[model samples]
Target chain A: MMNIPEDISPWLAIPVVLLLIGGSLITLIGTLGLLRLPHFYQRIHGPAISITFGAGSFLLASMLYFTVLQQRLVIHELLITAFVMLTAPVTAMLLMRTAVYRDLRNGRQSPDLKPPTPPASGHATTAGANSPGLMEETRDRNPE
Target chain B: MKLLVEIALYFSQFCIVLAMLLCMLRLLKGPTAQDRVLALDTLWICAMLFALLLGISFASLVYFEWAMLIALTGFVSSVALAKFLMRGEIIE
Candidate 1:
C-alpha cells in the first residue's frame, strides 16, 4: 500500500469529525422518522432531511479530509453533493404525486386533500377512478 | 495514530451500514410507493458513503470514481421513478 502521510492538522480533524458525527445523527433521525411517521406523505419528509444534510455533511467531510491528506484541491466530492441536492427533491416530488394519484384512484380519502382538476386536452387522462394499477402505470410513464 | 484513524473510519462505516439496513427494511415494508421511493433514495446515499469509506480505507482513487458513478446513476433512476409516478410515463 502506498503510504499517504497521516498529517491532518487538529484544526482540520475537528471539522471532519464534527461533519461525520452530525451527518450520522441526522441520517438516524431521518430513518427514525421514516419508521415512526404515520402516513406516506409525512414519512417522505424524513429521508429528504437525511439526503439534504446527511449527504451534504459527509461530502464536506470527504472534501476536507482528502484535501488535507493530498495537499491539493479535492473537488470531486462536490459532484456527489451537487447530485444529491438536485435529485432528492425531484424524487420526493414524483413520489408524492404518485401517492396522490393512488389515493385518488382508490377513493381513499386523505384528510385535507384537495381533488385534482381534470387535465387539459392532450394531457394523459387519469385511469378509471377505481384502478390503482392504471394509476401506477400513468406514474411510470410520466417521470417529470 | 494511524491505527486510531482506521478504527474511527471502520466505526463510521459500521454506523452507515446499519442505517442502510434500516432503510432497506423500510423499502421492503413500505405501504406506499412514496415510502419505497424514499427508502430507495436513502439507500443510494448510504451506498455512496460506503464507497467513499472504502476509498479511504484502501487509499485509492478508484473507489471515488465508483462512488461518483453510483451517485449519478442513482439520481437518474430515482428521477425516472418519480417521473413515472407523476405522469404514468417515463419518456412520453
Candidate 2:
C-alpha cells in the first residue's frame, strides 16, 4: 500500500475533514427529504440539496486534499464538478417535465398547475399562452 | 491528524451508505415510474461519491477514474430514463 501522509497541518486538515463530514451530512438530509416528502413535485425539490451543496463540498474537500498532498495542481476533479453542475439541473428539469406530462395525461388536477386568478381587467396573459394546446386544455378544465 | 482523516473518511462513508439505502427505499416504494427514476439518479450520485471517498481512503488515483466513470454512467442513465419517460420509447 502507498504510504498515506500522516502529517498534514491541522489548519489544512481541519477544514477538509469538516467539509467532508458536513457535506455527507447534508447529502443524508437531502436523501431523507426525498424519502419523506409527499407528492412528486415536492419530492422533486429534495435532491437539489445533494446535487448542489452536498456534492460541492465534497468536491472542494477532495480538490484541496489532493492539491496539498501532491504539491501540484490537481484539477481533474473539476470534470466531475463541472459535469454535475451542468447536468443535474438538466436531468431534474427533464424528469419534472416528464412528471408534469404524465400527470396531465392522467387528467390529474395538481394544485401546482393552477394558474393565478386573473384580474377583471381582462388583460392577463394566459399562464402558458405560448403553448396554445396546454392553455386551451386548462381553460377547458376550469371553465370559470 | 491522520486519525482525524480516518474518522472523517469512515463517517462520510457511513452517511453515504445510509443515503443510498434511503434512495433504495424510495425506489422500491415509488407510486410512479418517475419517482423510481429520480431515486435511481440520486442513488448513482451517492455511488459516485462513495467511489471518491474510497479514492481518498486508499490514497490511490485509480479510484478517481472510477468516480469519473460512475458520474458519466449516472448522467447517461438518468438522461436516457428521462428521455424514455418523455417519449414512450428510448431509441427512435
Candidate 3:
C-alpha cells in the first residue's frame, strides 16, 4: 500500500515492474510446490527454488529500483543474497539428513541407504537417538 | 508509468503475502518435523521478499537493512532448527 512518488520515470518503472511481478510469481510458485507436493523429498525442491531464483530476482529489483530513486548505487541488499546462498543449502542438507536418520531409527530402511557403520567411539548411538539426555548418554557410552 | 509501477508493486505485495500464507499452512499441518522446518524456512524467504517489495514501493533505503536483518536471523534459526532436529540437541 505504498503511494507512488510523482517523480519516478518510465525508464525506471519498466524493469522494476517486470522484475517485481516475476519475483513474486516465482515465490508463489515455489511455496505452492511446498504445500501441494506429496512427498517431503519433492517438497524440498520448492523452497530451494525460492531461495535461489526468487531471492535473486527480488534483490536485483530492489537494487535497480533504489539505485534509480536515489540516483546513486544502492547494492547493500546483495549481502542478503550472499548470506542466503551460503546458509540455505546447509540447512536443507541438515533437514534432509534428519529425515533420513529418523526414518532409519523407526526401522524404515530403504534399499538405497546402508545403515551407517557405527562411528568410532559411540558416535552413532547419541546421534541416532532423539533424546533430551543425549549428552549424558554419549558420555556414559564413551568412557575414554 | 507511475500508475503502472504502483499497481505492479501492489500486486507483487499481495502475491508475497499469499505465498507466506501458504507456507503457514504447511508449517501448521506438515506431517513430519522436517516438513515443518522446511515450511518455516520457506516462510522466511517469503518474508524477506516481502520486505524487498516494500522497499521498492516505498522508494526508501531503510527496508534493505530490515531485509538483511530478517535474512540473517532467519538463516540462523533455520540452521539451528535443522541441527536440533538432526543432533537431538542444539549445542552438541
Candidate 4:
C-alpha cells in the first residue's frame, strides 16, 4: 500500500487528523446513545447527530487529505458530503414517521402526541384507557 | 509526520468499529421493527464512513468508490424498509 508522503506540512496534517478523530468520536458517541436511549423517539435523535456532523467532519478531512496528496483540488468527496446531507435527514424522518404509524395503529401514545409527560404514567394510561375521557384528557393536554 | 497520521487513522478505525458494533447491538435488540430498521440505517452509514477512513489510511481511491457505493445502496435499502413499514408492504 502506498503511504502518505512524509513531507506534508504539520499544519495541514494536524487539522486533518483532528477533524478525523473528532468526527469519529462523535460518531462513536452517537451510536452509543442510539444503543442506550430507552424509547424509539428519543433514540431517533441519536443517529441524526452523527449523520449530520460526524459524516461532515470525516468528509472534510478526506477532501483535505486527498487534495494535499494529489497536489490539486479533490472535489469528489464533496459528492458524498452533499449526498449524505440530503439523504440522512430524509431517512431519519421516514423512520420516525414509520415508528409513529406503528405506535398509533397499536393505539399507543406516541411522543409526538404529548409534549413531555412522564413516560411511565403516559404509557400506563394509554395502555389501559378503556374510557374515552382519559384519551380526551390526553388530547386536551397535548392539543395535537 | 507519518507517525501522527498513522496514529489518527488507527484511532479512527478503532472508533468506527466500535460504533458499528453498537449499531449492531441496537439492531439485534430493538424491540420493534422500525427500531431495527433505524439501527440498520445507522449501521450502513457507519460502514460507509469506515470505508472512507480506510481509504484515507491506505491512500487508495478505490475505497472512495466503495464508500460511495455503500452510501447509494444503504439509502435505497433504508427507504424501501421505511416504505414497507409505512404501508405494510414494499410494493403496491
Tens digits of per-residue lDDT for model 3, B1-92: 88899888889989999999999999998877788999998888888888888777777778888888888888889888888877778997
**CAPRI-style grade of the A/B interface in model 1:** acceptable
lDDT of 4: 0.86
> Which runs of model 2 end up more than 4 angstroms from their true locations?
A1-3, A111-144
Give each prediction's root-mean-square deviation over alpha carbons. Answer: 6.4, 6.4, 7.8, 5.8
Off by over 4 Å in 3: A1-3, A110-144
**lDDT at position A15, candidate 1:** 77
Residue B54, candidate 1: Cα error in Å is 1.9
Look at candidate 4 and give me any clashing residue pairs. Answer: none
Considering every candidate listed, which one attains the maximal DockQ? 4
Model 4 agreement with the true structure over A2-45: per-residue lDDT tens digits? 37787879988999989999999999999999999987889999
Model 4, stretches more than 4 Å misplaced? A111-127, A130-144
lDDT of the candidates, in the order given: 0.73, 0.84, 0.80, 0.86
How well is each residue in A1-144 modelled by candidate 1, as lDDT tens digits? 423347656777677667777787787788778877777778888887778888788778878878877789998888777767877777777777777776556444442334334444423345442355654454344222
All DockQ scores? 0.40, 0.51, 0.52, 0.61
What is the descending lDDT order? 4, 2, 3, 1
Judge the docking of candidate 2 as incorrect, acceptable, medium or high: medium
By TM-score, how accurate is candidate 1?
Answer: 0.78
Better of 1 and 4 by TM-score: 4
Clashes of each: 16, 0, 0, 0
User: Per-residue lDDT of B2-92 in model 2, one digit per residue for the tens?
Assistant: 8888889899999999999999999998878899999999999899889888887787789889888998999999989988887888889
Q: Using lDDT as the measure, which candidate wins?
A: 4
Candidates in descending TM-score order: 4, 2, 3, 1
Best by TM-score: 4
